[model samples]
Target: MGPGETGLNYMQQLNQIVYPGIGKTTNDNDCFVKSRSIFFNGTTDFEQSIEEEMHRYQLIWENGYFLKTLKEISHILNGENYDWELDIDSKTKNTRSNYIKDAIITKFSKAPNFQNLLKEAYNKDLRNAITHTQYNLIQGGVVLTNIKGDNHQPFYGITFEKWEEIYSKAWFLLRYIFSGLKDIMELFMFHLRKKQSQVESPFSYQMVKNGSKHMHTILKEGTGGLFINEIALTISYISIFEI
Candidate 1:
């Protein structure tokens, strides 16, 4: 299937996974959950739908795997393997790279075409407007009031059509990264299974899936359980120990 189709399928499957308090607020006594919060829905209101779409795009742009994948790819390209995070700048060393734009322009300069894709996907001005709450909803689109043009003069915001284009590019980049990582993970798992077959081990892993796998803190325990709270899934495991 095409990438779009594959992405759609993946999203559909992801949406199907049931979580407690999903589409609802979790409190002692009150909550409401709606899938529309996560995805743009069949709302009749055009402006509202556009607003929701913009918010969704902004959310992903800030917290998505796209940036993380970029850092990991940069590390591999630089041929430095460490258990720790990367220090892109030694002068002011940080685990995270502060020079994200440099990562695209300078680090990945060898691949001009891919660089273009990254550049197209990332719009610092637009993100700034969204992040800093410097925009307003117009008849057809929101105006980034602070964003200026080549002459360094403030211009009107992008059209709804333009915003849609930007959002699509960003979404495509996300799916592309996800697909690549999935392949790598599958290959790694295959190798892991192969290695396991060649070893005789006393250790046995027991996975108990109560629901969707989430990492919860195993605070008061001899054994540890990883809870992936972001996905709201619960998977508990017991490791066989010779006790």
Candidate 2:
């Protein structure tokens, strides 16, 4: 049964015992006794509540980290440059890691320290971890402890968690990039089609040979359509294919 349902059952039992004459059926007395003992146990019910809350707190913290990273990257992408540093205070030393920064930077931008891309990837991973981890925790999954070293830690698998974070970041960043890229490509194709329509022989070698026309079309018709179109063109030409 669900936690609320279980809690209700316990309350029912407590009621029967406290007011014996009110609902003193044999079944009711039995249920009341059983549920009262189960609910009062410090380990089972109380510990479960604490675990759920902790998992939720962790999820929130991770999401916060992701949002912060995205904002930082957005600032960098806006042409403001800054040093990308991964800070880990002693309190979070065990849980926090800097490897995420390297992976994000490598995946998103040509420059080794492309701050925007790095931030975006970081945010993406954070969101993913929070989402997936919460899902696992809600399903009654046990949090395994690290008994290897001096630190007696309780957490899930490190590699799996890290990988989940990394891939999630990559997936989200790539998705964001691709969406912009697709819009630009569509705009570019539109221009090409418009130019071809205006020409005398749209399929002729001369029409195909007009490089200046293509450039002019992009500049005039494709440049100012929408932010998505502009971003798409900028990323496609500058980042991906290098036009």
Instruction: Point to the candidate with the largest lDDT.
Output: 1
**TM-score: model 2 vs. ground truth:** 0.27
**In model 2, how large is the Cα lDDT of residue 204?**
14
Q: CA shift at 65, candidate 1, in angstroms?
A: 5.2
Best by TM-score: 1
10 residues in a row with least lDDT, candidate 2: 201-210
- lDDT at 106 for candidate 1? 54
**What's the residue-level lDDT of 155 in candidate 1?**
65
Model 1 lDDT tens row, 162-190 = 77678777666665555555665566557
Q: What ranges in model 1 sit over 4 Å off?
A: 1-44, 64-66, 86-98, 148-154, 195-243
lDDT of 2 by residue, 1-243 (tens): 011332343444333322322111233424322443443333665345433433333332333233333333443444543223323222235444343444334334544444454554444333444545432222223233322234554444333234334444444443354355457677777875665444442121212232322211222333333223323333343343232
Which pairs of residues have clashing backbones in candidate 2? 13-32, 73-116, 125-169
